[model samples]
Structure formats: structure tokens, C-alpha cells
Target chain A: MSMTLEELTDRTGLTVLDHLEQQVRIPVVDGLQAQGDLIVIPLAVLDDVDVPARARWRPVPPSGVELLRGAAGGNPHTLVAEPGAAEWTTEVHDRQRLAVGVLRATRPAYLIHSEHGGSGIAPGTYLVRRQRERSTQRGGQADFLVAD
Target chain B: MRPTSTAGTGRRRSATSGCGPPCTPNPPTGNAERAITGLYALLGRRRPRFHWAASPRQAVDLLDEPPLRLGGPVDPAAPWHVAHQLADAAHRLAGRLDERAGPVGTFWWTTERIVRTRPPADALAAGVSLAELLVVGVRNSLGRSVHDGLRTPLRAALTEAVGEPPGLRWHGQHDAPWVAYHDVRRRLRPGLFHPDDDRQVDLWADIARSCGWWWPREDVCVVTERTGVAHTEALPGALHGEVRTHNRHGPAVGYADGWGGHSWHGTAVPAWVIEEPTVERIGAERNVEVRRCAIERLGWDAYLDQARLTLVAEAADPGNPGCRLQLYDLPQHVWGTPARVLLAVNGSVERDGHRRRYGLSVPADLDDPVAAAGWSYGLSGEQYARLLRRT
Candidate 1:
């Protein structure tokens, strides 16, 4: 299931900058991994999140799904997988309210980004959460989602 | 079953690529005059006197009366009101075209939102048709760029420079949105609209491509030339060829009469931001967003050093080996809020192979840097301490 950055970009038609190393095989990690403002955590690692019974799941197409876009809006963190190997849903309830969606993959899935490069996920179920920082505007104590 | 063939997709014929209106400094006045004459003919009136101005600011001085007479008794003997006639004709034409374009259901609404916000490639990947892409391109995206991005700020700057405009005016180049919308629809579907409506649409399109702003009066029409210089950059994450005004050193948009505005990214700011971003000026600035933009212009480290914010706590970042997260108390009077700043280093290295430092605002209550860092990720201090890797 391991693939190099070059092969992954070619398969998905998503691109990374020429500066990133293209030949090295991306590691398929089963544990936690962070890419910029997004973090991927194994479902078993946390008990605060739950996927509802009636949650609708969408198959991750060959073109991939854009999980998050960078602050200035150019770079996108895209999740891609082989046909029929993965599915995604935003129906999960998180206690922290940071979870963007949940990813369930029967085969290896890779998250590709133009600046941060690629992060491979081993076959498993995981929760993808966006990072947030405290907001200082207007004196409200609510946290704002981190964009980058 | 999914349709595998691209027969009716209109991918080849649709002009989705480079669909935005041209931002030309010198527009063709000849075509514009002809279009205005055609529009006058449609209203069954003789052509009005055409007065050309080098810029909108100059055109404002040429008006004898307010463009819109808000509330007044209509003279029964008057031949016609040019503005009202033009508006009514355009509205009826749009109504007929909308009927032919089909009903905009929930699916169309959702797709339109995606087309407006995300990249065109993303919309295409989501199964949006090429024709729909063109619709959003010429309408939503072009409107965002020409009207919202360029015209709005320029109008504001003009208002600030001169008092409120004395007359009502129409944005000639900025009207590309609606004009191009009708033009694209008729061009794509061909027989979808009436031939008469098609001719009217063409005249409006010609005016859009040939001028800047204009004032239409009963006996006279005043058309202004385009800006002498306009600087813009790609709107981050735009689905079409959308752009916003931006210039680091000077005015983003400037006219022949020396009227212009300065912008950072897409946010319109005072000329001082681009000219002289001094710490003293930034401190006195009341707007939080403006203050932030000024601080960014002067690097975070430099601002923190010059402002001399009191340090509260510092801790070694959990995952980032050598970097330390530092917290500083923000002055209540200056910030107008109870908050602290957490300075941290970027996890990923830039193209230069050096990690960058950034600051994030945090609630003033937290004194522990690790706890503040944990708060950012929705994890407890102990939970975040076990972090393994950062990209």
C-alpha cells in the first residue's frame, strides 16, 4: 500500500510544489499524525467522539475529498484513496467540537497538501479534527477555528 | 447509474477558462457610444449628449442634478425617464431568461455556493456541469471581483476624498456581472432567449467592456474612462479568475485624476498602512483588524520587541523539539479586551528550510503555556503532553 509522493500526486491529479521530495515512500502510520492545522487520530485513541447510527457515508472518489483549505485559500489538504478503499462522514459528534469528519478506510489512504506534502494513514478508522485558538475579538471567550 | 459519456456536459464548448472580465485601463469608447445609442433607440428616444470624463471623480463634477430624484411628482407631460426605462427593460429581459434557465432548486443552490467559494477544479470534481460553472463564473465570481472587490472600495475612497456624490451613477465596467450573465446564457443555449433580448444583451455587454462608470440624464449621458492603474492579485481559493485589489507599496487602484485607494490582501486600508506602518501609529489605531495588518507588516517578533509586552510564561513545545511557546499579557487599553498572546513556532519548515514564529491570541486567564497550547487543540495539558509528531 506504500506509495511515493510523485505516484500519489499522479494518481489523484493533485499537485505538490517541486521543492518536496518526490521519490521517498510516504510512511503509512497507524498512530496520531498532524499536518499543519489538522490532526488525524485513531478512533480508539479517544472516547469523546461518537459516530451516529444513521450517519450518511460518502465513498471517497478517485479525485479525492478536500478536507481543509489553507488560510489564504490556495493550499488544500486532500484525502485520497484507491477506488472503494475508503469512505468519509461528517456525522460524528465530538465533545471538544473540533472534529471535522471521520474517515474509515479498508486500505491505505493518503492526505496530500501542497506545502506540507503527504501523510499516509494505515488501514483503520480515524477522526480528522481542525485546530482552534482562543479568540480575542470583542471580548468573547469562544475559540475560533485555525485556518492555517 | 452514473453517466460515463460526456455528450451533454458542454465541457468542450463552455468558456469556463479565463471567464472573468478584463481589467483594462484604456477601454474602447467608440463601442460604448454605439451601445448607448442603441439603448436610446430601444427606448424610442433620440440619443442624449455624450460627455466623457477621464475618471469617475471628474464625472461627478459634470452632473447638473442628482442622478436619482428619490421622491417627486412625475410630470405627466414628460416624454420619458431614461433610467426608469432602461431598468424596466433589463428587468423584463432577465425575467424571460430566468424562466428559460429552469428552476433553481436546493441542489442548484448548494452547487452555486460551492462554485462561488471553492476552486473550479473542486467544483468540477464534485460533478458540477460545465454550463453551471460558466453561469457562476460570469455572474458570481465576476461580480465579486469587479463590483465587490474593485468598485466598492474605490467608491468608498472617492466618497472619503470628495463629499457624497451629487448624482446617481451606473458602474459601466462593473456592470459586467449581470450583462455577462445574460450574455453567457444566450451564447451557451442559443435559442433559449428571444432574438430581441439577445440584441439588448449584446448592447449591455458592449458597454460593460468599453467603459468604467457613467451617469445617465434626460438630455445628457456622462461616461468616465477606466482607471489609469489597477493592481490586483488572485483571490485566495477563488473558483474562477477572481481577483481583489492589493498592492504592498502603493495604491491598488488609481485613476488619471490621482484618485485611488490602498488595500492589503482584499481588505481596504488607509494609505498609511502601505506607506508608513510605525509602531506609534499602529498603537493609536482603533480598529483591531487594521492594527493586526499593521503588526503583520512589521513582523511579530519586531512588534513584540518594540511594544515591550510583559512576558507571562514560557514552556518547551510538546512536539516541536527546540521551539518554546511564550505567553505575553496584552495591554487592556490598547487591545480594548482582556487577552494574552501566545507566541509559538510553526511545526512545518518553509521553503527556506527555517521554521517561522507566529502569535495567536488567547484568553487572559491562562498562565500556563502548556495548558494554553492544549486549549488550542481541545486537549488537556496531560493529554497533549503525549503528542508524537508534527509535520
Candidate 2:
């Protein structure tokens, strides 16, 4: 079922609040306007992100899923598309440890690859929560509400 | 046509013709122009950046300047032997250079190895970047190498570079020190994984190197193995090693492998519990089982709802389940701005299943009697801040 961006925000803490608040004061050309149903937010960026308090909200760590950095540097986090092959696929040996996940209905549709190695779950969207203020956002953030 | 004058080493350039070209032709005689043209044709394709000498005399003069030599001793200066010696040195040093050194470093190293001594005054003016010299070496070394077969060109190139005559040897051990780290990279990485694409191999190699784990040849799959889970299907020939078991021959009470699977309602296992040696698992189980009896009574959600922090224990290991009492705190009400605090008590008792799926809310400060029951599981202040910040 398709959910609005607001409902998506309620279920999964992913939001474009930081982007909205930060860009609100910046003066730009008329052509430079934000648009799109898919709002991408990086939990963290190398650049400064100045957002507002009204838009701030705590992120609940996704239940039954833990974000882990690949053995490679950058502490990159990803969801494997095939949770069953996790041991051989994403683990040290397989060399197929790609970051896998997509934002569905503004919630993280992660490929849960855990030590258990396999899951009965099919390759479909599953709601996931971000770790508290992981400081990155990606996916659709359309409603640009400035409540301040 | 033997080298015009070998200095009597009898090591004719012909000896390495089978290895690849730029096999220095018969040293220039009266037909210096003919010899110079042939030399340029043979080597220029690969090292186009280097200025070709207009005549044999020029080629010989280029060598008059001592060239850097990397792997062996200095060659004697002999004008008659100049062209041949340079060719020989280039061929020998080609594959020997390390890919890790990158283009510039490899160039510098190659020149030092080939020149055998200081370069001529006009070395830079001669018009060749260090990159050209390296290209010559790499190309020559790789030229004769077959691209595919049981003995593929990749293998041949590796063998030449490693300087190990019969070629690569595989022991299947991740940490085979004798093997050049690059040659047996596939085995060094844990798993029965083979990259189907070159990019995959590169990506894996990058990750492996970044982890500072290229040596000691550890595999992720190997370390992930636990009791009862047979890896023969997953790892094939690699499961010769055994894990620490509780009762030398006791039944393998392998972990659930799924998170929160150790509890009565658990479908997975805990990582911390899995880390404890097999022997420790037995003792830990008895303690966990007894606590499970209490938790089953308190009711899971009811116990969790009342407290701000929840301690979760699973059935994997009773003693070191790594389960802790997670205490929740809100400092904003007592101080100013709202702040969340998560205190994980390390030394909590396992008598009751409270450590597993139970929460406790204490007063604003740490004066509660439960605070003294265990040490704080080492979450530093910075970590706590990261954990608490909402945005």
C-alpha cells in the first residue's frame, strides 16, 4: 500500500526536516526550487547541515535489524537483498558486500542480512528505522513544511 | 647475432627472446642506423613516451648515463654493450615492480633498478617520464604471458613478477606468507568466494586491504562458524578447523544465529553469547534457564513497559550472554534541555531473567540501590551523546 510522506515519517524516522530547515534561509534563483516525492537525506554529510528544532525528531533503531559497517572503511551501512546468502555473500569472503536497500513509502526497505544467514522473508519492502540521528537521509521528502 | 660485446657474460639477449621483445638486437656495428630503427620499433610501441634515439650512437649515448637498478648489482659501463644491457634490465625489472606503488612510485623504482647507477645529466631532457620506463617493464613482462589457459597470462605475469620459477602455489590458507600477498589474494579473503568480474575482485581487495587484515589471511565466514552449524556445504574444503566445544564430545548446542533467538520465544542467537567458548556455554545455560522461568512469569511486554531501560538475555550462553541492564534516563527535566541517557549495567545478576528483556526505571540520579549491583558496560560519554542526539 502506498503511504503519504507524513505517514512514512511517523512509522520510520527518516525525514527531510534537516534539509528543509537548512535551506529555508538560503536565497536562490526562482528556478532553484525543491521538488519531488522522493526526498533523499544523508544521515551525515561532509558539509554542514543546519536544521531547525521544530523539525528535529529522534530516530528509533530499527527493530530486529542492526546496521553494521562493512569490513571496508567508511563504516558504510547497507541492507543485503538476499539475507539468506549473507554469510557467503556479504561476509569477508564473498566479495559481494554491496550496500543494499531502498526507500519505500519514505521508510527504509532494507535487505536484512544477519549472522543467522537466511530469512523466510521474500525480496520485498520491509519498514526499517534508522539509528538515533544517523544524520543521513535518502528517499522522497516532499512536504516542505516550515512550522517555525 | 650475439651481442656485439657481452663483456663475455655469454648471456646473449637471445637467452630471453622467449621471454619477450626489446631483446637488444646485435649491438650496432657499421650499420648503426639499421640497428637503431629496429630497437625503436621493438620497444617504442609499449614505451611511446620515451624519445626514440635518432641513431644507434644516440641510443648508446643515452645509456652512457648510469641508469637506476632496483633488483640487482650495477652493470659495468661498456659503450658497445649499452643498448643490450638497457633492454635486458628493462625486461628483468618489468614484472618485479609492485602494483601497490602506483604509477609514479613504480616509475621511480623502475628507473632506479634499470639505470644501475645515477642517470646522465640530460636524463630528464632526454624526454621520458618515469611512467614510460614502467610501461616498458610492465608490457615486456606481460607480453609473452599467455592471457588464458590452465596457465593464464595473469598467472604467468604473477609468476614472473614474484620471481618464483614454477609459478603460484596455493595452500588455501588465508595467511600464506611465502606467497606474494597479491598472488594468493583470493585465498587470503575468507570464504569459498571467487569474483566473476574483475571489478568485484578489485572491490574485495580494497575492502580487505582497508580492514588492515590482508595478512594473517582471515576469512569472515570462518570466524562466523559456530557449534552445530555444519559449514561443509558453505565452505567446502575449508572446514578443517574446529571450534571450542563445551563437553569435549557433547552435543553441539549451536546458536540460533538469529538475533534474540536464544530466549524461549527467540528465533535467533546472540553474538556475545556465541563468542564464549563452548565449555562456558554449559554453565551459562543453567543460569539462563532458571532466569527464563522468572521471565516467563513476569510477562514480557509488562516487564518492558514499566521501565525506561530494558536488559535482554537470550539462551545461547548463560554466563556471558553479554546481556546487560539498560537504564533509561531523561536529564532535560532535572537540568535544562531534554537529554536521553542509556546506562548499560555490565555486572547485573542473571538469577532473574531481568537482564534479558526486562526494564527498570530508577530515580533521576544514580543513587538507586540497583546502580550499585553492576558496573557500567563501557559506553563512553561521547558514545552516549551520539546515541542520544535525535537529529
Candidate 3:
């Protein structure tokens, strides 16, 4: 069943800004979804990424796993799921060096942010990647990760 | 709460509460003077003549001779500098304390690693005790906040405006982290350190709680009052009340002598960046981070129009219906680099019911807006084109 922003926050004890729509049901997407600077793509969509055989996985806790915090350090994009419903691993090899982690869910898991609200993930394995921009300070071809 | 968690909670509470230097302008109390005298007594020296200053800026000016002369040959006959003697004593004391604290084990290392990285809640949930959290909080978190966060930046600014300090200085308030760390250890693990060492730690802790900065010499000591005005904001993800200097309208940290610095989200920047950011000023600024901060202060839309950058290309953003991706050339003089700016709209609506637009710097060679956008996500232009949804 899909959950609203209020329901998700209440379940996880996480909070969002009061301005966000609280009652609307958050969509559970089986495909790709973007939240701020983070993008979640179904594992089947990418050919250059791989999850190794010896990868360690930790079950997503009730309080959720904080995936990324904003540049200034306040807002965080947290991944939440029913206990035992999802497992996450950081041992993924991505050609682009942008993969934050890989998430495998047996049931619907949600990515929640104070500003972006919640984006529900359908039961599936997915690769989460952070965005980057060209770095002008270093004078060469270096990329700076976007924290927001 | 778990019954066993109370001890941890108490330790965590005390550590956070005792974490930072007092920012208010409180003159050093008689207790501070007693502590300094006690420290001198430990070194077999009499109490030095105390010279007080309103601020660190004024304190530097009061020095008749450089407290520390760099790159000089050691003279065996010359009396040891009081500062050096104190440093040596502190090192030896710490060594003895370490012996009592026991060897660093895997558990300690694991907890330290987790404390340094993950959120405090996560570390606690992972079975890290509150006492351990207190240790890391005082050593790492408080150190980062008081020493690295505030003192270092303020020191750099002071050095630029004045020069290298006249002598080796002691951060009176900024020394809270180290002192607090030892104090917490002694309190939590009673009798972990010798009584004499505990007394020494108390002296240092008193000074940290009492003043701003200090300089110690054989016959004289120079002490500065606390900052008259200091502004700070909670570090975004800090688990132990860590804070950094941040003020949009005025100096993030200022003293009574009108000496202070401006910071934008912890980054020390020139006053103009905060006060009068203009396109011309931003173009002339060589530092990339400073320039970016100025541009952000000026807003992207206003900067684009005022800078009048040449439009390179434009395309509709996939999945973000009605939003367009526009590219503009950043002049060599403007950015000091061969790069293009891709202006994209946020996928989510903001609280004000408006979508925010931001610019991403891309390699100059990419002329196609779609390819540039794809490059940001490490995907091919064709691959990103199949995107289905944006929040």
C-alpha cells in the first residue's frame, strides 16, 4: 500500500516541512525516480554497474538509513522501509564513480527528504547515484559532487 | 528508553553541554587568575604579570618581542621558554594518562570510526555506548567546532589583516576540546588519571571556560577577553551540538576591538561578497569558491542577465515537463576556466510554489544541453533520455 508524507514521517519518526502536502498518497514507482540531486535507477537499466558476489548487506532499520545529507548539513535524504523489507550495500562498482549505494527491497521502500517530501520505491533492486558538476577550481577535469 | 541507556545518555548530555567555548564577553574571573597561577606554580615559577586586552587584535599589539622566534639555533645555556616547558609537561602527562586508559582496541576504533562518520543515532543504534560517544564528542566534534570551525578561520583572517602573531598563543576558549576531553575521561572513569594530573587538567579547563585567547611568557602573560559578538549556526548534521560561524548580514565572529571576519556558511569570505556582491566584482575575483558564493548571493537569474553570457544551446529536460535546460558559455576572464554553465530547473516544487533554477558547470566541449545534463549523472545522452519521473 502507498503511504502519504504524514504517514511516512509518523512511521519513521522523521519530520518534513509543514508546507509539504501531508495527505496526498505518495506514488510507488517501479522505474526510475529523482529526488533533488539523487537519482534511483532500476538495476536492469544500467549495464556498467555491478554488485559483487561478496557484497555485504545490512537490513534497513525502522528509523531508516540516511543516504545523503545536504551540502550545508541540515536536510538528509533517508531511505526507510519496514524492518526486514529492504537491504542496502555500498559494495557496488559503477563505471562513473557516482553510485552512492545499491538498494534491494522485497517490499516497497521510501526515500524521504524534508524538502523533497517522499518518493516511494517499489520492491526491486536499484542503484542510487549522486549528481556531479565540473570543477573549475582544480584546473583539470575533476568533478565536484553536488550535495543538495 | 532502555534502563541501561541512562548512563550513556547522562554522559552524552554532559559532553554536549560542556562542548563549546562561551561566546559572550565575560571578563576572566578571579578563578581564571587562580588557575593561571596554579599552572605557573606547577612549573616552579611565580605568577607572571597579567596584561589584559579587550580583544586578540589588541593583544597582538601589546607584545614587545615575538613570543616565539622561528628558525633559531637552540642555546643550551638559555632558560627554557615557559610555553615550551608547559607543552612538555602536558605531553608527559598525556602519556601517563594513556597508559592508564589502556591500549586502543578494535571496539574503541570501531566506535570512533562510526562516530566520525555516521549520525550519532545510527552509531548508538549500532550498539555504541553513550560514554564512548562522549569521548568522541569532546575530542572530534567539539574540536572540529571550536578549533577548526571558528578559531582557524578567525586566525587566518586576523593574520591577513595584521600579520603572523607576535608569539605562540594559547587559544583560551578554543582550547575547550582537548581540556574537555581529558576532563570527561577523568569524570566518567574515576581515578583513571593521577590526582596531580587531574588538577592540571582542571586548571586548563578553567582557562578554557574563562577567556578568548592567551599568551604566556616567563615574567608576563597576555590574556584577551571573550568576543563581544559571535554568531554561529548548528552544523547541518552534527550529532553533538557542533556549530560553525555563519552570518549573512554581519561578521560571523567579531570582537570588542572591531576586528572580526565574515563567513558564508562556514567559508571565510571577503566582506564584499556578503555586502556588495556584483557581477563585475565576481568576475575580477580569482578564487573560484569566492566567486561562486558571490554569484549565489547575487542569484543565478540575475547573474546570467547581468553577466550577459553567450547562449550556447537549449533543450527540453526529459521527465521534467515544461522545464528547459539552457547552456551558456563562461568567458575565460569571467570563470578563469574553459567551462559551460547548464541551467536546469528543480524537479520538485519549493515551499513558495516555485521551482528553483540552478546552474551546473560542465566541460566546455559539450555543446549539446542534453549531453551535458547526462554527463552530470554519468549517463549517456540517449540513456538519460529514457528517464521516466522526477520529484
True contacts kept of each: 0.55, 0.00, 0.65
lDDT of 2 by residue, A1-148 (tens): 2333344333434333322222222121111011110111221310222223333222223432334433212122223221232211111111111111222123223222211111122222221222111000111111111100
Q: Which docking band does candidate 3 fall into? A: acceptable
Specify the highest-DockQ model's number.
3
lDDT of 1 by residue, B1-391 (tens): 0101101211211222222222122234667778988988998978877777666766777664544455687543432367667767878877887677775323468888877776678888988876677677767777778777777667767676666774445777778777777777777778878888788888888787676788776767888765666677667546577787777777777665556777776777777877788789998898876776676666667678789999999999876788898998878765667778788887767878888787777778989887777777776667666666666
Top-down TM-score ranking: 3, 1, 2
The sequence of per-residue lDDT tens digits that candidate 3 reaches over residues A33-100 is 78889999899989999999999999999899999988656699999999899999999999999999
True interface contacts retained by model 2: 0.00
Where's the lowest-lDDT run of ten residues in candidate 2 chain A? A30-39
Better of 2 and 3 by lDDT: 3
Clashes of each: 1, 39, 1
Q: Give the TM-score of candidate 2.
A: 0.18
> How good is the docking of model 3, as DockQ?
0.41
lDDT at position B74, candidate 3: 52
**Candidate 2: which stretches are off by over 4 Å?**
A1-49, A52-148, B1-95, B99-391
Q: Which lDDT values do the candidates have, in the order given?
A: 0.75, 0.24, 0.77
Model 2 chain B scores worst on lDDT over the 10 consecutive residues at B213-222
Going through the candidates in order, their DockQ values are 0.35, 0.04, 0.41
The docking category that best describes candidate 2 is incorrect
RMSD vs true structure, all candidates: 8.6, 25.0, 7.7
